[model samples]
Target: MSIDANKELVRRLVEAINRDDAAAFEALVAPEFLLRDAVVPTPRGPAGFREAAAVFHAAFPDFEETAEDVIAEGDKVVLRWTARGTHRGEFLGVAPTGRVIGFSGMAVFRVADGKFVESWQCHDRQGMLRQLERAAACEGGGGR
Candidate 1:
């Protein structure tokens, strides 16, 4: 596919993710797609990817993602994004603490035939952990 087409495909993928549209995500991801996440412990395939999204949706019911920047070259697209949400469900084995958190991340994706074939992602894991810690403390009626 052309570079523009690759970029468009990635754009739609991000839109689908932001909407928490599992079906749309499934359609856009190749069967062999590989997802490497910084926070999550496991590398994910399509099913795992879907499960990861479910985890995010469950933890942050009102999660929102904003794409700050995107650059495409050949079959690869790199994206920078920020996401914000409130903790309402379990995350990383922590109980719901109702903390609001935001984090920024970057992802590089390889698209083939308009489907995401592979992705490498890095995010502010330490920042997220700190937010969770503060929330837990608050929920425990302690001042940080």
Candidate 2:
């Protein structure tokens, strides 16, 4: 696929995540898709993506990610994005504190055959955790 098309594929991925669209995830991801990210436990295939998305949605029901920039070259696409959400469910052992949080991240994807073959994601996980911690403290609770 062309570089622009590959970039679009990633953009659609962000859209799918915002919509929590599982079918789109299946369509955009290759059967052998691989993920490199610390926030998720199991990091392989479309099911992994779905699980990660579910975790985020469970913790932050209003989660939304916005792509700030997208760049592509030689079968690789990089996306810089910002995500915001309200904590409503437990996450990473942290109990829900009903606090809104935002963080920025970037993901680099290797695309082939019009689908994502592999991706490496880096985001402000610490910031997310810290915000949740503060909210927990304010509410007289703690991470579980």
Candidate 3:
């Protein structure tokens, strides 16, 4: 596919994630898709990808990621994004603090045949954890 096509594919996937459109998420990702990120523990396929999304939604019900930039070359697309959400549910064992959080990250996706085949992502996990920890402390609670 063309570079623009690859970028569009990624854009649609992000939109699907933000909208929590399960069908679109499933359709956009290949059945054998693999997501490599610090946050995902299991070896992931499309279903696993969906599960990861569920985890995020469970923690931040209104989670939204805005793409700041998207660049595509060959079959790979790189996206820089910022995400914000309210912590309303447990996340990775961290109790909900009802705090709004924001973080930035970047992801590189390998698209094949118009489907996401693989991805590698990096995010400000430590910063997020610190923010949550501070919130927890302020609330007279301890963080994990």
| Candidate with the greatest TM-score versus the true structure | 2
What stretches of model 2 exceed 4 Å from their correct place? 141-144
Best by the lDDT measure: 2
Q: What 10-residue stretch in candidate 1 is worst by lDDT? A: 38-47
Per-residue alpha-carbon lDDT of model 1 for 28-112, expressed as tens digits? 8888888888666444556666766777889999888788888998889999999998999988887888888999899999988
Q: Which lDDT value does model 2 have at 137?
A: 90
Candidate achieving higher TM-score, 1 or 3: 3
Estimate the TM-score of every prediction.
0.91, 0.94, 0.93
Model 1 residue-pair collision total: 0
Q: For model 3, what is the C-alpha lDDT against the true structure?
A: 0.87
For 83-107, candidate 2 gives per-residue lDDT tens digits of: 9999999989998888899989999
Q: Which stretches of candidate 3 lie over 4 Å from their true place?
A: 141-144
Model 3, TM vs. native: 0.93
Query: Once superposed on the true structure, which residue ranges of model 1 sit more than 4 Å away at CA?
Result: 41-45
